[model samples]
Target: MQPILSLDGVAKSYGGVKALTSGALDLYCGQVTALLGENGAGKSTLVKIITGIVHADGGTITLDGKPVVIESAEHARSLGISAIFQEPVVFDALTVAENIFITGRPLKGRSVDWPTMMRRSREILAELDPSIDPAMVLGRLSVAQRHLVQIARALSNDARIVIMDEPTAALSHREAEELFAITRRLRDEGRAILFISHKFEEVFALCDRYAVFRDGAGVGQGTLQGMSSERLITLMVGRPVDQVFPKQVVAIGEEVLRVEALGRCLEYENVSFDVRRGEILGVYGLIGAGRSEVMHALFGTAPAETGRIVLNGETVSIRSAQQAIAHGIGLVPEDRQRQGAHLRLAIGDNITLPSLGRTTRGGFLSARREREQAAPLAEQLGVKMSGLRQRVEDLSGGNQQKVVIAKWLATAPRVLILDEPTKGIDVGAKAQVHRLMGELAAKGVAIIMVSSELPEVLGMADRIMVMRRGLVQGIVPRSEATPERIVKMATDA
Candidate 1:
């Protein structure tokens, strides 16, 4: 079968730095083709080249077996190609109807045609979701709803090839399911879907074919039916990873953190859990189960109004993150892009930011000490980078995560809080992170991990604590932490 779109020898460079050496892909109608790679492996560059955001240094693009020149984003849109980014690029000021019809609102003799636009918007959106009101402001909708509007706009524009870049990165499990269903509908309608993501489970579940890129080159491309997840990881990383989860059993010691009836009105109430030295306690729950909220209170992101937090047998009141740090607590938030790391800063700076006091002498910061303190952690975590001066934002998703973990580890806290540590990373990276966690546990650093992936909880956690409506449903050992038991615990009151 002829491909609807194909790229031959697609190459790109920036300031003499080659971003892509030989990028290539083929998108066929009625198929979801996954673009797989590490964060800096040239997947985004290829996407940008196809979307006309950046001009390729050298390549031939054939659409329907005919050579075509795409000069700009508008040109790509005109050719029935549209992209929905990780964060939906929608106009917050405009209503849902206006956003869907922004490309070409129905014109009426030099006047805006609001009625026709609304009707058309409603019609297109009805296919995906009928509950959304076309007249509602785009900013008023939830994150998932905003994504739906983006999809509706692509469909309304008569897009034949749609690109989804990490569509489920921020969505909950339930929301991701909805997006997956809509993607299937588009595939059934004969539209070519290009799905780019880091989650192995999602790629295996949603994609029919895959094009794998590694170090700015295409390594493999084929149907998903016969491929194993390990092979896919190897292709993405150019290495044979032994195990994705390197869990190590350590002797659990004295309790490092003791929370007594931690409660915040309307969010969570009477939540209590204990973490022992060298142990990882995994927090499992559905959305609104108050998992993150509990962590927030524990780490002083959002303090609990009523609770007694005892660290090392000393009752301490942590009113801010600074105080928490003073009490030897560290937290790596779920949203690494926002709360965890400073994107514009270099790796050394980000890692040593929290431990600046240690790197200072007589009220002056020591660059040598900063490097000495951060270099080992980065090396131990196997952070891939050209130099310590490289910006954190330029690294791949997995490397960026490594930088985040390095920052917290530099503090050398007795207790570490990891919220969704491997949210948007490849399988190999996930394995590396799991190994790091196991190593940390062996070093006697108590870890509190909050995650939605049941398998991850079952794999790495010493104890699984299921939360429901701001309460602890049950705490079970690893031997008893089955999916059925966890699900039941999460759903039960």
Candidate 2:
């Protein structure tokens, strides 16, 4: 079969930063091509080039064997190519139906066909999954909902080629399955799908053929029929990654953090749980099942009105995040880009921001002390960067997550609360983080991990607490926890 799209000697750069160098790739009709890479490995940059968000400096782009220069995103769209970004691009002012048909609404003669658009949007969403609300404002929808709208927008254009970047990063297991079904439907209809993801399992399950990217260039490409997950990981990282999960055994100590009858207005209620000194307590729930809110309540970001927080056998009232930190508690929030790190700041600056005062003497910063503290943590986290002076925005998604954890590690807290720490990170970096968590637990630091991924909770937790609709449905030991049991507790009011 002829290639639907092809790139020859493609290159892109941002000022002095070379994102892609001498790269080549191809997309064929009615097939799913998985693009694998580490954070900052230039995956996003390459997608931008294909979508005409950024023009490539040197390359030949051909559609259907004819050379073409896509001057802008509009030009790319005109040629029946569309890209769904890592972050869902939705206009908050528009409704879900409007956002889905934003480019060009279905028309009836001279007037806009509102009924047709709404009906068509509903049909598209039903094809994906029928739970979405068409009349709801885009601003009011969840991350998952916005992602569906973005996909619907691409389908509305009748695009022959579609590029999805980290499409399942924000989805739950069930939602991800639904998305895979939709992708297969698109493929069966002869649409070419370029799928980018960090999860090798998803890639292997969905892609007909896949390619690995390392240091801004394609490393390997082949059919997935006989490919092992191990081989793909080796190609992406240039080393053996035999195990994806890195759960370490540790002795559980006495409870170091405890909550009794925790309630936060209408957000969550009666959420009681505890984490021991040398154990990880995993909190599992659907998005908005009060997982993130529970973390906020514990950290004093969203104060609990009717709960007793006993830390190390003493009742403590945490009214603010500062008070929580002072009481030997540190929280790595869910949204890293917004709450965890300062994107414009240097990596070193972000790493030390939580404990700057501790490293200072006589009201002056100790630069030497700061570097000494950050360097080892960065190394341990395996952050691929030139130096600590590099801007956080320049780092990959995995590296940025490491910086967030490093910042909290600098605080030297007794109890660490990590909310979705490995959300967007790759398989290798995720293992490193899990290893670090084990090491910290062995050192007597209590850990509370809130995650939506079922496998993550099942693999790393010493005890699992399942929540459903603002209430604790059940708590089980890791040995007894299964996806079925957790899902039951998470949805069984």
Candidate 3:
């Protein structure tokens, strides 16, 4: 079958750095093609080039076997290509209907066709995503709903090709199912789908054919039929990644962190959990289920309306993150880029920021001590950088996450709280993080992990706590916890 879209000898570069070398990609009608790579391995650059967000330095692109010049995003869209980015690009003030038909609204003689737009918007959105209200503000909707709006916009434009970059990254299993359903509908309609994802399961489930990129070049390509998850990781990283989850089994010590009847106004209530030294307590919930709220409250980033927290067997008042840190509790928050790291700072500076007091003499940081302390931690975390002097901004998503982990680890907290720590990282980094978590737990540190990914929760947690709307649904031992039951509890009122 002829490919609906094809790139031949495509190449792009930034200064001396090659984002993508000469490479070929094909996406056929009624098929999904997954583009898999480690972050900075050229996947994003390739997508940008294909979508005309960035022009290729050298190559040829053919749509329906006809050479095309896609110089801008508008040109790409006009050529029937649409992309849903990793981070959603939607204006908060606009209604769903308005955003969907922003540029291409049906017109009636120099006047906006309000009635036609409303009717058509409702109809098109119902076909793509029925649950969303077209009248609702785009920003007011959940991440999943906004994603659907993006899809509706593409469909409304009559796009023959759609690119989804990490679409399932933030979605729950239920929301992902809806997305998969939409993908099938698009495929049946003969649209070419290009899927970019880190999760091997998602790739296997969605893509008919897939390509792997490594070190700025396409390394492998084939049907997903005979490919195993382990083999896929091996191809992407150029090394055998035998296991994705490297969970550790450490003997649980005495309870070091305890939450008693924790409640945050209108967010979470009566959330109670315990984490013993040398133990990992996993918190699982759908987005907006208040898991993050409870964690934030515990860490004192958000105030608790009513609750008591006992750490190291002492009842403590944590009014701020500094107080929590002083109490020997460290938190790696969900938004690492915004909250965790100082992007402009060097890798060593970020890693050592939390424990600078140890390297300080009379209120001044000892540069020598800071450098000496940070080097080992960065190395231990396998952070890829030229040296400690390299800026954090230049690192990949996985490496950046490692820097965040290194930052908190330097604090030597008795209890550690990680909120979506492995989020947006590659498989190799995820495994390493899992390994590090295990090592930290083994050192008698109590760990509380909040994650949306079921596999990570199941694999790493000594016990699982499932949360629903503003409440703890149930806590289960790892041996008894399964994906189905966890999902049920997470959605259960």
The residue-level lDDT of candidate 1 at 155 comes to: 89
- Candidate 3 lDDT by residue in tens digits, 1-493: 8888888778988999888887678899999999988777888888888888899888899988899878998888898999987777788899888888885888899987888888888998878767778888888898888888889889888999999998988787788988999998998899999999877668777789998888778888878888887788888878776466778779898989888999977898898888899989999998888988888887788979897999878898988988988888888889998998999999989988878788889999888999888999999999989999999999888899999988888989898899998899877788889999999999999999999888889989999999988899999999999888998898763
- Best-fitting candidate, measured by TM-score? 1
What overall lDDT goes with each candidate model? 0.91, 0.87, 0.87
What pairs collide in candidate 2? none
lDDT of 1 by residue, 130-169 (tens): 9999999899998999999999999888999999999997
Candidate 3's C-alpha runs over 4 A off are 58-60, 67-69, 93-98, 101-123, 129-142, 170-175, 386-391
Off by over 4 Å in 2: 8-18, 21-24, 55-62, 65-71, 94-149, 170-182, 200-206, 226-228, 361-369, 385-390, 482-493
What is the TM-score of candidate 1?
A: 0.92
User: Which has the better lDDT: candidate 1, or candidate 2?
Assistant: 1
Positional deviation of 22 in candidate 2, in angstroms?
Answer: 5.5
